[model samples]
Target chain A: MSTEHPEEGRVVRFPTGGVSGEVDIGQLFDAHAAYLVRVCIRLTGSRAAAEDIVQEVFVTAHRRRGDLIPDSNLRTWLYRVAVNLVRHHHRSSGRFNRFVDRYKVDPREAPAGPDVDVERVERAHLVRDCVAELSEKQREVFVLYELEGISGQEISEVLGIKLNTVWSRLRLARKAFRVEWQRRHGEGDHP
Target chain B: MSGPRRLMDDPDFRWETDCDLGDEAILHEGLELGALKERVLAAIEAPPVPPEPTSTASTLGASGAAVKGALGVGLAVVAALGVGYMLGAAQPLSSEGVAEPEAVIEQVVSVPDARLPVAAPRVPAVSAPEAHSTEVVEPVASPQPLHRAPAAVEGGASEPVRPAAAAEVAAVVMPVQSEAPGTAEAPVGESGTVVAEVAAPGGVDAVDGSRLDVEMEVYDTAVQAMASGDYAGAVPAFRSYLRQFPGGHLSTEAELSLLECLFEAGSFAEAEAQASRLLQAPGFGGRERELSLVRAESLILLDRCSEALAIVDALGERDSRTAAVRRECKRRR
Candidate 1:
C-alpha cells in the first residue's frame, strides 16, 4: 500500500539508538521487498493482502535489524519472517483461509487441456492448489523447496525442524501431489 | 501439456513444472517493480517508525524457562501488591458530606503514609510466596519503589509490604459509600469536578476531584501484570478494580479491561458471562465499541459464530483492527 518510489528503497538512514550492525532498511527493502511480495502472493494468494503483509515484515525487520545474526542469510531470515507473518496474518485475519475457500484450491494440479496457455495457467493454479492441500507444515516444505528455491537444509534451519523432518515432509508432500495430480488429470485410470 | 506425458515418468518433472508455472518469471517481474516500481520509489523516501520491543524468552528455547517462570511469578505478585499499595486512601473532601471539586481532586490526594496499617496479615487466594516475596505485602524496615508507580504511588515508605495490607487497604480508605459499587459516584458539587473528569474517559484522573484512585490502583496492577504476560495475575487485579469501582468513573475502562484479561487468560466461559453482564449494565457507556469487540472475540472462541456476528454488526465503527476481528468472526460463522 506504500506508494514509496523505487529510488527511495535505494538508501536508508539508521534509526537512532539502534544497536550496531543494523541493516539499512531502505537498501534492504530495495533488495528484497519485491521478491518478498511475490513470495507472499504465492503464500497468501492475494495481491492487496500480500502487499500489506510484506510491508509489515519490512517494518518489523527494520526495527529488529540489530538482532539479526551477523552470519545468517538475510534472504532466509526474510523468508522466516514472511512465513511467520503470513501465518499470524492467517490466524488473526483468517484471510488465507478465505482465499483458499473462495478459490476451492486443493493440492491437485488442474487438468491440462488441449489449449496451451490455458493449460499453463491451469497448471500454475494446480501447483498452488496442490501446495495448499498440504498441511501447514507440509506446505512449508513444498513452498520452500519447490517454489522459493530454498534447500532442504535451509528450510530445516528456518523452520527449526530437523533435516530429516524437512525431507520427510517434502517426501509426503510430493506423494500427495502425485496422487492428486494424477487423479485430477485423469491419468491414473490407466497408462 | 504436450511435452509432459513421458516427463511425468521421470518423477523429476516437478522442476520443469515449477518453472512452467511462471513462478520464476513472476519472481523476476516482481523484482522489476514494473508499475509498482513507481510506488516503491516514492515509498522508500519516507522515514521509518520505531520498532516494537519483542519478548526474547518466548522465542528462545527452554534453556532458562524455569528461572524465567519463577521470576515472572515473583514479579507478578510484587506488581499486584505494589499497584494496590498505590491505591492507598483518600481523605474526607467536605464536612457537609458534599465533596468539593477542588478539595477532593483525585490526583493530588497523597497516601496518608506509605506504610499501610494492617491489623492482621491475610493470605491471598493466589499462590503462596517465600518469605522475601511475602515481605513485599507487609510493613517492612525500608521503603522500596512501587514498581514505577507515578500516580497512585505518591511518596515512599520504609518497611516490608504485606499482602494483608493490600487486601484490607479499604480500612484506611476514605468512606465514599461502598454501599453501591454500581452508583458509587456521588456528585461532588456541580461546578469544576464531576462533569469535567467524566468527559476525559481514558485519561489520568485530574488533581481536581476525580473518582479513580482505587480503581486506577487495581487497574494499574492488572495492566502491569498483563504487560509482563501474567494474565492470570491480571485477571484478579482487573476484577478487583471492577469490584472496588463498579460505578466508579473508570468502571467502563475497568470492565473492558477485565473482559480482555479474562479472554487472554483463556477463561472463555467466565469472559462470556462477564461480557453478557457488561452488555446489560446501563452504566456501560463509551466502551460499547471495545466491549463489543471483546464480546465478539469471546463468542468466536466459544464457537458461537452467529452470536459473535450480531455483536460485530452492533459495533459502531470499523477499521483495520476491527476488520481483522470481524473477518475471523465471519469466517467462524
Candidate 2:
C-alpha cells in the first residue's frame, strides 16, 4: 500500500496491506485527513465545502472499509473518494459557488508565510482562478499534480485513468492554466 | 518517442515558478489539520444526513415546474431504472480482482455527468397535441439536446429550419411561454415545420415551462447582443448564461457564442483556451466541427499554425471555411 502525503511536509505511514491492516479509522484520519482536506479545499475553493466533502469521504471509507484489499493503495482510494465527492458537490451546487468562491479567499485567514503581501495574495487569487478555469477532468489532474505534488502514476491510480490519459489531461490543464493566467494577469505574461 | 511533460521532470515549468510561493501556502492559506481530525472521526462515527436536494436541474431547459410534480414522477421512475442499470453494470469498485480497470475508470469519471436529471426518458406525454409531442421529446430525448426549430423561429419566420436557429427560437419562445401560454398552444401550418412555426416553442413550454424559457431568454439575449456586434456586452452576457445554465443543452450554444465574442474581440488566446475547455467537456458533441474551426482559427491567429493544421486535417472537411483556415495556417507556417 502506498503511503504518501498529498500536501508537502505532512507524511503518512500505511501498513503493508493498506487500510485493511490493524490500522483503525482514526489512524487513517491522522495520516491523510489533513492532506485530503487541503486537496479538497483547492478542488472546491471553499473551506466549508472542502470540510464537508472530506468528512463525507471518510464516512464513505468507513462504510466501504470491508471493500479494502490488502494490495489496494489506501491513498489512491481516498483520493478517488474525495474527487468523486467534490464532483458531486460541483453538480449539486452548480458553477455559481465556484465563481463566487474564486474571489472569496478570507482576509482573516491569510497565507501561512511570514512575508505575505498584497501582491502575493493577488497572484495566488489569479492562480486559483486560472486553475478554476480548467474543465473538471483537467482540474482534477492539474490540482493533484501541480498543487498537491502527487506523482503521475499515483494520480493515474487515484483517478482510475490510464497514465497516458493523465499526462494528456495534465498537458491540456497546464496550457489552459497558462492561457487563463495570461488573460487575467496580463496579455503577454508567460505565467 | 517523447511523452507528455511532467512537473518533476521540468523544474522550469512548474506553477511555483509562476508566482514565487509554494502551492500549499497559497492554496491551503495556513489551514491546518489540527482539531479537524476529531471532527472527521466523530462524523464518521455518526454519519450526517445528506443535504436536501437543491432546485438545480441537471438538464438545461427543464423547468422547476417540470421537476416539481409534472415531470418529476415520470423522470424519477425512469431515473430509478437508469440508476439500477448503472449500478448493476458498473464494475465493482474494489481495486483488486478488476479485469478492466479502464472500464471502471470510465464509469467512475463519467458518473457526475450521468446523474438523475439526464435520465433519457423519451416519454411523449406533453400537454400539446399528439403531433407536437414528438417535437418536445425529440430535443430532450437526445443526450445532447439542441435548440432547433425554436432557434429559427426566434431569429425570424423566414429563417430556415436548422439546428443553428434553435438558440434564437429558444429566446423568442421563452417570453411567449412566460407571458401567454395559450399563444404557444395556437395552431400553425405544416407538420415538418411544426417545431419552427408553433410546436417547438409550445413544445418547450408544455414540457419544461418557464424554467427552460428563462434559460433560453438568457442565452438568446447574449446571442442577440453578439449578433448585433456588441462583442463586449455579449461576452459577459454569455458568461452569465453559462454560469446560470452550465451543463444544460443550451450551454453548448452559450459556450460557442462566448468563443465567437472572444474571437471577434481579438482575444484569440482566450478564445482558444475556452474552445479547448469546451471541446474537452463531457457530452461535448453536435458542434465539434464548429468548435474545432474556432479553435483552429484562434490558434492560427496566435501563430500556432502547426496545431491549427493538425485540427484542420483531423476535420477532413474541404469546405471554404476550412479551406481558408488551411491556407492561412500554411501561409503562417
Candidate 3:
C-alpha cells in the first residue's frame, strides 16, 4: 500500500517488502516519475519517447534492485540511469536534433484545449532546440539545474561531476544557449 | 530544495521565470503524469516475453517454457527485493530535501559496472523508419526580440534544426556511430544530413566484445546500404543479418527493416506478406501499431482497399497517420 506525504504529495511511501529488502519501487515511482519525465522530455524532445525512457529507467532500477542499499540517494541514482539512457537514445538515433524534429509533436496538431496556445507551444519548441545545441555536458547540467530546478550540488551528484564543474559548465551552457537563442529568435532578443 | 547558489546577473536570460510561460511550466504542462505512472506499473507487472529460438521461429514448446520460468524467477527475485525495500528494510530516500550529506550519494551509488564502449557504441537494434512520418516543416522563426538583461530566468529547449531530409516514399534510415578513436571521417552524410557525435561506451568481456563487434559491422553494412538509397543492396544485407543471428536481440528489428526495404523497392506484395507473418509472431506485442500501419499501406498499394481499410480501422481513428491511410483507402475505394 502507498500513501502520499502529508505535505504537497511530493513523496509517496510504500509499506510492502521487496526481494532484497530495499526501497519500494512503487514509492520511488510515485515520487520521482513526474520529475524524471519532465527532465527526459527536455532531454529527448519527445513526450512519447520521454515516457518510454522513464519506464525503462524504472525497469532498469528494478533489475538492479540489489544496488539500492540504505542511504543510497535513489533520486540521484535514478537520474544517473536516465542520463545514461538519454545518451544512448541520442547516440543510437543519430543527429538527435533530427530525431527531435521527427518526434516533436507539431504545435498545430497539439492536443486541443482552451489552455493550449500554439504560440506558447512553438516557443517552447524553440527553447528546446536551443538547449539541444549545447554540448552534452552543458546540456545535461543546464537541463537539470535551470529547467528541472535541481540544485547545483544535486546536479553534481546526478552527473558525477564536481560542484565547481557543474557551475562552470552551467555558465558556459547559459552563454551558448543565449547565442543560439539569439540566432533562432533573431539578434535583438536575448534568451 | 536547497536555496540556489549565487546568481550571475543577466537580464536577457530570464526565460525560466518570465511569465506563466517559464521553461519549467511550459515543459510540465500537457504531460499526463498519472496515466504515465499507470503505464509504468503495468509494464513492470507484465510477463516477460521469451525470445524466439535460434533453430526456428515457431518452436516454443518446452524450451520456451524453461526460458520463461528462468526469466520469471529472475523477475520474482527482483520484485521481492522491490517489495522488501518497500515493506521493511530499505525505506526509499525521502524527497524531503535536495541537499543530502555528500557521503550518502558517494557510499551508496557507484557508477554501474556494465557500459557500452565509449568509442563507436552501437545500439543493438534499429527501429523501422516508417513508424514516423517525414512530413516535417521548417521551424517558424521566433517573433519579437526580447531584451537580454542578465537576471536569473528559466531553461530552454533543444537546438534549432532544419528537417534532415525531404519527404520521400522511401527515406533512407541508419544510425551513425560517433567516430572511433582513429578515424578521420567527415561529420556530414553525402545527402547533407548532420551526424551528431557522442562519446563511446567501453568495457565488456572478450567473447561479448567480439560478438558485438561483428554484429555492429554487419548491421552497419546494411544501414550504409540503406542510407545510400540502395534498397536492393540493403535487402540482402538485412537478410544476411537474420540468417547470421536468428535469435539475436535485434532480429525483429532486422526483419522489420527488411520488410521496409521490400516496400520501398516497390515490392508491395512481398512486404505485406512479411509484415503479416511478423505481426502474428509471438513476443512482438508493442510493435503492432507500426507493423499494422506498414502492412496496411502495403495492402493499399496492392489495390486491396477493403483489406487495408480493415487493418486501418482496427487501429482506431486517432493517429494522424492511420487517419491519413483511412482517408486514402476510402478515396481509392
Candidate 4:
C-alpha cells in the first residue's frame, strides 16, 4: 500500500513483491523538464512551441514508464526522444518556407547587451550575413566545425554524413568564406 | 613533400602568425566563431525536463480516472490470483479438506470490494462483457454529454475541456469489462480498457505546426551567412532564433553558429558572453571541454592571452584539440 503524508512526503510501499512501487512524478518533472524545454526551443525557435513539446515528452514518458532505460543514460534517451518529436513536428508543420522568410535577417546585428560597441557589432552582423549566403552543406560543415567546435567525428554523428565529406565541406566553406570576405572588404591588390 | 604540405611548410605560406588577412580581420573572425560555439554549447548542455503529469491528468478528467481505476482493478486481480495459487499449494490433503476449500472460496468471494475501493462507484448488475461496451452500448452515458454542461457553464467560450474533466468523461464512457471471468489472464485486455477510457476527442492536435521548419531554415540561413563571410548577418540570424527559443532543441546549434558569427564579425564581448552562458548550462557536460576551448579562443581574441592560455592548459589535460590550439597560441605569444 502507498500513502501520502503531508509532513513525511509521498511514499510508495510495495506489497511484498510488485513493480518496484510508484515513482514521484513531481521529482521526475523537476529534473528533466527544463532540458526538454531547451531542446524544443533550440529545434523550434519558439518558447510556446518548446513548452508544447515538453508537455508531450512528459506525457509519453509517463505512458511508457516500464520502457525507460536505466539511470546512466536516461537523459541521453530523453534527448533522443525529444529529437524524434522535433523531427515529427517539422514534418507536420510544412511551413519551412514561411519560417525562412520571417527570420532572414543577420543575428549579430540584433539588439543585445548595451555593453557592445555599435561599430564592432555592425561588422559582426556583416560577417554573419555573408556566411548566411553559403550553400546548405557548406554552412552545416562550417557551423559544426568552426562555430560549434565539434570534432569531425561528432559532426558526422550529428549530421549522419561521411567523415571525408565533413573535411571536404569544411575546406570548401573556409575557402568560400575567405573569398567572400575579401570581396566585401575590397581586394588589397595581392590577390 | 606533397604540394599542399610544401605550401603549408613554406615560410611565406605560414598558417601561423603571418596573417595575410591582417590582425583586425582575424580577430573579427575569431570573435564570431567564439560566439557561434557558445550558442551550440548552450543548446547541447541545457537540461531536458518534461512537463508536469498531474496537469495533463487533470485535463484528461474522468477518462483519466477510469484508466487509473482499471489499472487498480488489474493490480487487484493479479494479487488475488497469486493468493489463490498460494492457498491451493498450502491446502491439507484428504476428502474432508475439500469442504475446507469450499469455505475458503466462499470467504474470498464475499470480500468483493476489498481490493478495489473505486470499483464500487458502478454496480456490477451488467455482465462483464456488457460492461466493457458501456460507452458504445450506452451512448447517452457518454462523458462528452457531461462535458457539454461544463463547457457551457465556463461561458460557451470555446475553452478547451480541462484535463480533469477529460479524465472524468473517460471514466464515465469506458465499458466496465472487469466482470468477465479469466479475462485478467490476458494482460492485453487491460490495454484496451485503458485506451477506451482515455480516448478523448481532439486531444492529439496540440503540437505546433511551423516551428521546426523555421528553426531548420534559420540554422541554414545562419550557416550561409557564415560561408559568405557575412558574419554580421549570421550573428543576428542565430541570435534571433536563440531569443525566440532559448530552450530550443537546436539552440545549441544556433548558439554555436551565433558564436562563430560574432567572433568573425569582431564582436568579442558578445561572443564571450554567449560562451559563458553555454559553459553554465548543465546540458553541456559532454561538450563543455570543447566549448571551453572556444571560450579560450575568445579570450585570446579579446587580448586576454593569459586567461586564454590558462583555459587552453586546462583543456590540454583532456582534449588534444585544445592542446594543439594552446601550443599555437603559445607560439604566437
Give the TM-scores of the predictions, in the order they appear.
0.42, 0.47, 0.44, 0.27
The worst-scoring run of ten residues by lDDT in candidate 1 chain B lies at B130-139
Error of 2 at B174 (Å): 24
lDDT accuracy of residue B23 in candidate 2: 39
Q: Write the per-residue lDDT of candidate 3 for residues B126-183, one digit (tens) a residue.
A: 3332122122122122221212112211110011111111111111122222334222
**Model 3 TM-score on a 0 to 1 scale:** 0.44
Docking category of candidate 4: incorrect
TM-score for predicted model 1 compared with the true structure: 0.42
Give me the runs in candidate 2 sitting further than 4 Å from their true place.
A1-20, A95-108, A112-118, A187-191, B1-11, B14-29, B47-333
Please list the residue runs of candidate 4 whose C-alpha ends up more than 4 Å from where it truly belongs after superposition.
A1-114, A183-191, B1-333
User: What range of 10 consecutive residues in model 3 chain B has the weakest lDDT sum?
Assistant: B111-120
Decide which is better by DockQ, 3 or 4: 3
**Rank by DockQ, descending?**
2, 3, 1, 4
Best by DockQ: 2
Model 1 clashes, total count: 29
lDDT of 2 by residue, B1-333 (tens): 234444545667555345432533565655666566766656554533332122122222242233323334433333322221111112112222112333333433454334223222122111222232112322232122333222221111110111222222232112123334333322211221121112224324444344454455555555555555555666666665554434333454455556656765667798889878767664333235556766876787777889988997886523334544665555445
lDDT: the better of candidates 2 and 3: 2
Residue pairs clashing, model 2 = B147-B166, B150-B169, B151-B165, B151-B166, B151-B169, B152-B165
Arrange candidates, best TM-score first.
2, 3, 1, 4
Task: Please give, as one word, the docking class of candidate 3.
Answer: incorrect
Off by over 4 Å in 1: A1-26, A95-116, A188-191, B1-333
